[model samples]
Target chain A: MSDGDQMTPSRPVRLATRTVAISVFLLLIAGALVTSTGSGLAVPDWPLSYGKLMPPMVGGILYEHGHRMIAATVATMVGLQILVLGFRRTDRTTFRLGLAAFGAILAQAVLGGLTVLFLLPPAISSAHAGLAQIVFALTATIALRTSLFWSRFTDAAPRAAVEHGLRTRASRLALWAAGATYVQILLGAIVRHTGAGLAIPDWPLSFGKVVPTGAEWATDGVLAHFLHRTFAWAVAALVVAAALALRKLDAIPGLRRLSTLWLGLVALQVALGATSVWTGKAVWATSAHLAVGGLLWIAGVLAAVLLARAATLSPAPAAAEVGEPQEAAA
Target chain B: MRTDFRSDASKSMKTFPASRPLWGALVPLAFLIAACSPNAPEAPKAPAGPAGKLGTAVVAGRVTLEGAPPLNTRVTMATDPFCNGQHPGETELPEVAVGPDGGLENVLLRVTEGVSGVYAAPAEAKTLDQKGCAYSPRVLAIMTGQPLEIVSSDATIHNVHAAAKENRAFNLGMPAPGTRYTRTFEKPEIVPFRCDVHPWMRAFVAVLPHPFFAVTAADGRFEIRDLPAGTYTVEAWHEKLPRQTFTLTLADGETATHDVAFPSVPSA
Candidate 1:
């Protein structure tokens, strides 16, 4: 039912969409690097770096300007996807999806500009970061939908007797996980932006306690960091639940592999977060923490889409492997 | 990387980049023009500071703190090897520097009002140096249109960012040791300067229309000499304490000794 029979998949559009997704992810990391290095105000001008197209990349300028450059790259790739998807309106769903993504990217750019112009106010900066994840999830979903895997899965779905029910459960769980990851990302942004990442300074312990005390809560740094840690556990629980649910169905090796990847990313993301605070907010650790967070959001989204698609597709177990030469082929 | 992210932003900040070649050429030009627009305020003209030797009337003072001295915390400088190498041992920041005699260091005293006239800026330039990864003379005052030359003495990079409110803000990177850049403020405001590389490094500059301001010395003494006698409103500022202001009417050749004890009026 989710399938778009009108879509004539083009390899170039899919490749471009994936490229945009990857670039946006990198741009997010670059942005994290700028914040980690305290380079947001280094250039001190909007839509430009130091009154020039390219100021000498040195010091904070390197991180700040580098981020702008990557954002531009992401914009260009998104533009390319937009052109191909809307050409002759060949695929209405994909084209509309691309247009929506294009709109989000445009808004993302505005938020980015406003973040700089406002001298990095925490609220606006955090919003800028939050929207970036949305843009990433959108482009990443676009990539997933345009892929050969998506085409194959949708065409040959519901191959197992128990798959529909299991996928329905997994799809719901994955959606919740994605939402949790997004919330975690927002919390993490606050922690980073508010400089609360090291308020506790000790891992597996909050100033030597497993839980925050009343006195600790009085300190804003402690509160933000505590909330980030607490939300992370919730996110991990949902992701693991979804992964296990997918595994329970024992159908679609690809979905199983994606779930495993999500589980691995969750574990790695937590470690990077700890590494960030433990290492005194090292650029690499904090940036990777952000990068991994972006990936988790996208992966959760992909899992949700694929599982939901698998659950709703027409049952075609006999023709799944051999292909429907008579019906689908024509 | 962890060191970079581990800042206690709750303590000091409520916080939180790209692009092109030919496209960059045009876009940044537009921004540059907007920055250079005439909407910015102009500096007061003619005799803004004290006329040389015009008045013997002097406002001398000691700024003292009533409360316990601030706990100067040790800043983590491990992120930059250059900064770390500069301080081999534990170093506490001069957040509240009080001499043994209780004279507070780094309190800025300026004639805020009742002294009117366009003050000509001196030709000699004021210097703001970044040495040993610290800003020299943490608090200073300058007349509007007076050039402030910013220089870096550390081999590492230091971006001098002026957190200006009444004037156009600027952020410029001084990458190498002895890299010098000059700028002037066109408005009267208290501008806070900071280094992005070393968050603990801070300096404050009071850009005044007149040269009637002085930062307290190490012994908590501040003397703004040769003031043209007149009624004036003097304000004293300390980073850790509330700013205190006093009203005085000094006659020609009169030296007024004023003492400021903080936990200022409002706080008291």
Candidate 2:
């Protein structure tokens, strides 16, 4: 209606947030379906098919074209979310996060095009997948922020606490955990795109050997597989450590519950990873493993962000910004 | 009201804010955008024309094995034959060159260049498909103007790399898992199709110009047809046997059959 109406402080309800979150999750599931069906090249030619807009969607063409269609829908809705943020005059953090998410969506689109034009080159495909994980994390973060837990997670008290010197260790620990989780996500991308999953045919032991020993170990195939397997071990260790650290700060019920969920997700992810290998890269199982990995990484990052925010929320010597609640924390 | 003060504060803070490196993200975005350019496979040349089809030819043979029943031997005739105008003497022909079970070896016949306005291919020419891990028909006879279609029926991939002269060479990949392809040669060339994927998979395609060829049976019997009522030289050739040549004349509406015995050679 009017400019004033656009700027009016109209807080979106929790139901709307849940609906958006569910939609994003469904989009991820659809993507997993595309990969599992091996429809990546259903439409061999890109940008146009058989020199027409609607080429016959037979064979691989249907899968690839369907993936593009769903991706476009996701991009449009995410863009709409950014517009809504602008119109609603949400928190400065919310507006900035929306802009970042929009940029990521555009980047993801470009990457998808590159994946096609490059004939699915392993490196670009891997990077495209890594960026997708980041987008998934961003959407999940937005959902987290809009939920009832948002205000508890973004408590602006952390920066003031660092200035006042209380609960400082907890904030630093959570930041490190978040960074580690991000690295784990990148490694998982490398594992999938390098075609290394089958290199070490047998699970745990590579080529019936303990260490994948020998001078040939320096090769890209061997190295990528070895690094991925090693990182799985590291992920297990870091996730357990992060959960323990969060356990020490049990006062925040939300963070504790999230930490436990994060640990459970990590365990499921590792089991899926092994099953993917043991099952000869069965399409359905591999896709499920990918999906769970994305959810686990997002959950890990969300928990770290929330716990760090809560750690900084301990009371201070002086009351500031009275009679006003802090903007939704996340 | 605190509104004016807050507006001024926000505006001033925005103006003096740190210069964010937009290129930090833009650089990677550009890198990703340019990632896969110039990587797709180039389109191949368009196909030349419609492929030729298979035709029928009447073949009959008679063979006489000396001092034996010629049980499991073969004799053949050819049209458009590769005689090269050369024939060996009858006395020089080897004895017992045929297999113990009466199997005949090399027989060169011709679908001679022209007969009654029709081209005659060399007799005794064959195309064999090493299909299903077994030779298709276990025997074949090919003539001129016929391009052989060698197919793989095994569940594994195979390559048909014909090792022959007088034809272009090709080492093509087969479709994976239950895939087959057909290729034709317009000229006579003995090319061996070998599967590099499965080196054990191999077949031979003999290209000829006319339709006159036969593979000898286990009984050493042979036949020649459409002789044009003229005198012509006949020869038998086995890849493993010394060749034998004979002279015969064909009259109109008459079929000529001959039997020749091949003796085995002593071990060196």
Candidate 3:
């Protein structure tokens, strides 16, 4: 093996890594389309569409069957990626992550089946959604680590302390931000697939009253909806906080710019959500809201992964320098 | 007190036309009463059309099948008049079933109002035939206060039950094929029909106060006719779907047609 090849990957494998990442983003969009079209239950009975491999794609079958088709495609891509990573590449961490992504995809497919068989019980559906986001983030991380930009970050100067350093604070803040954003997305999925979007009606405030009106509390459906809206507020706050932390890290120009974009998307997402409610969940508005939410999630995960990797690599240059002498002795 | 009572009775006798032959005097008495009223001063004028040509309002539509058997179902349209008690004509069509290729027979039908301004068809008149242990048409539209006739043509007995939220619950046992009973829906609702005997047998009935509705045929076509020229909200409701509403304007001597297609169900 070549000296650089032993540490880094070959160009083809790196290219494959990028392809998988792009595919992950595509899969997220596909999932969003399924949700936007209200095709979650299109295939009424799961693991089969009307008890056949190819059922008529009319009505519910179109959405449900389409979801299955997309899922199967994603699964196949993940399998291929795993095989390529294991046999064709020597990077242990990337290979392991690929395996983890594959495992998650399988579990997600099972959860999806359970959701359909049980008539899309809310919890399973939310998990299916959440896992997809996680898998998406994982795929993205793998791609980021293999990119040329990541190599440039390797030689960047290390910062001092967690309180004052750009790398430390941004990394710490972004990890929390990613976690909160994911949970918020899961809550949104629950809100949507559970028919809770219209439960609260008035956006920013629910039922012409805030903190929930007692009279409507008796209806569980409405309560679920109210909770979803409230969680949206929490998500907004977290995004703003994440943006402020990014501003605090003045040294990392790329991350600061990325966080700004992330926050702007979040703001737009909040507006779209409001318009969706105001418009009485018009199909178009709801679909746009869903689409924007997916974008925000992707952005948040991207920001987190970049910052986290930056932190891990903060000590890498010094260690590499210390190890250079050992290589000379050898 | 006796004298006062006698005087009042004598006055009433003089005013009332009871002494003459009862039938003979009644016509004159009715005429005098009509003359005294200003609103009916001209008497009850008959409409200017042949009695049989009494303007017919039609609710015609097609029923299509998505899954399961091609349904041969019964669809009914009737009205419970709120303003006037008199409705001239009541009509019904035979059980119309869907074909294997998801085609439907035209259920062109009408209904007249019942006494007390409530519209109804006889239980024997309104029937949904279960020919091969399947609801002939998976959907039905009938007027409120009319009985839904569920008939079993199969050899085995079928227990018919309707899960209705706004109407009284009906659970009936059909003893055998050719045995039938009629159950009335006193209230308006969209009730889902089910046969407990055949778990897969499912149908829907929408009991409306006015007979201004029709189900779309397999070809996704529907026509509502003879509506008084005005603006009204026409709603399309499917048992398993959300209700879709459209506003329609009908001019006098004009028939308006409305079409509705349900968004396909999602694939599992």
lDDT of 2 at B144: 40
* lDDT per residue (tens digit) for residues A281-327 in model 2: 88778888888877777767776667545544554444343434556
Tens digits of per-residue lDDT, candidate 1, B1-268, equal: 0001111222242212224442453344444433543222244344444444447889898988776676776766765677788886677888788889888999999988877656678878898999988999898888888988788778876767787888877566564676676678878888999986577788998898777889999999999877887898999988768789999999999999999987622221
Question: What's the C-alpha lDDT at position B78 in model 3?
Answer: 17
Q: Name the lDDT value of residue B161 in candidate 2.
A: 43
The models' CA-based lDDT, in order, is 0.76, 0.53, 0.59
- The TM-score leader among the candidates is 1
Candidate 3 chain A TM is 0.83
Q: Write the per-residue lDDT of candidate 3 for residues B15-117, one digit (tens) a residue.
A: 2222333124223433343233211111212223222211343334444534543223332211212101221243222233345655433322222222122
Instruction: Tell me the docking grade of candidate 2.
Output: incorrect
Give the per-residue lDDT of model 1 (tens digit) for A1-330: 132554536777667777888888888888989998888876655565544467666556678878888887787778778887666344566667778877887777767766665466689789989989988888888788777787777666655556444566777898999999999999998888787888998987878889978787888688888989988999999999988887786557487788789899999998998898799889899989999999999889888877767755744246556455667653
The clash number for model 2 is 94
Q: Pick the candidate with the highest lDDT.
A: 1
Model 2 achieves a DockQ score of 0.05
Which sequence of candidate numbers ranks them by lDDT, best first? 1, 3, 2
The digit string of per-residue lDDT tens for model 2 on B77-98 reads 1110111112212111222335
DockQ of candidate 1?
Answer: 0.13
